[model samples]
Target: MRTNTTPTRKQAPVINFACPSNQSGLTALIARLSAAVAEVEKWAPVEDRLSLEFSKTADKPKVKGGVTKAQQLISDGEPVLDLPATDWFFHTRDAIEEGRAKALAEAAAEDRAAIEQRYVALLADWDAQEAAYNSKKPRGLAHAKRMVSKAHRAWSAAEAAIVDYEPQTLAEAHELLAYAGLDGKRVFFTPGETDLKTIMRNAAAAIALHGLN
Candidate 1:
């Protein structure tokens, strides 16, 4: 019998994805999250099969000299001994591979689930806030403007919630929040603030005139 005792080789790094520069902050984050989830889903099935194979075969006893008792009995009546079997080596390798695959698959699955939960919750919260804004009615033009301003504020806050996640997802999330003007700046129009472009432009002119005087 011939036995090969070489150690298992380590897997090489593969670059499966890279965020594009032209994508909006939110788009980039979403793309990355989607890729991560897809990878986990792709490998989960292989991991399951490997784990099952290991469980069914790892504990079975290995025969000495690579021969089962029945094979040894059959060999006794023959002129020469039959070739030794190599099941032991193959079984050992399978056991090791199964363990590795199971661990990697489980870890990836956890990360995928976390990102999905956070992403869904963020979308739901945004929809709920927008719906609340839409349901309000205004009695006059001035009130209507105020309502719009309030809604903008609510929308900004809702968008902020979309970027909340664990450290693993923070790099993309922070970029998205910064793009949405939620990174500690009061970007959205507040109640009583004049945010209409025409109004603001006229106000700027009035301020200049007053300064000259």
Candidate 2:
């Protein structure tokens, strides 16, 4: 039995290069790299087999006491070791590709969250505007109702003032009422002398009186 006394040296760190300027670009790149790595890894042998073979060859004595066996080993083991390079490259590539994919996925999730937040803010603004419009609707309707009442009163008084008059239709009365309301004038009648209700009643009385004549 040969006593194994070769000191182990740490393996060189693998190099990696995977970065993106933007989130979308990063996601696309990651996907492409991961697929390529997966295809390569599928055909490659397991890592443990490669590691064991490489370890045995690497641990073989470079110098046995005074005799140099490194040259002899290199000539014999070089071809065998060369076959495992493809498998080693595939494993290293897969690790890098998987890491990039994970990073991209995380970034995309964050982007989606940001967009949702913006939509929520916009919806809140629209709701506020709708609430304001609804709040003002009743007040606007009340003001319009008051204006209509005022016009009806003014037209009634005007029609009563005409002593010799042709009877007007309801449609014509409504038109006249609208015009009187729009006409910018303020008239003051004494409470007993002439009220709008009294004027309207008299107008009806005049119509009946004329019919009798």
Model 1 clashing residue pairs (backbone): none
Give me the runs in candidate 1 sitting further than 4 Å from their true place.
1-16, 60-162, 165-213
Report the lDDT tens digits of candidate 2 across residue range 1-213. 001211121222111223344533223223333433343343233343444554454432111112222322246545533322121111232343453455456667657666555445444544554455445443244444444344333323222332112225443333323322333323221222233344345446645655445
lDDT of 1 by residue, 71-130 (tens): 432555577555554433223334444534554566676576665554454445445544
RMSD of each: 27.5, 42.4
TM-score of structure candidate 1? 0.23
The C-alpha lDDT values of all candidates are 0.39, 0.35
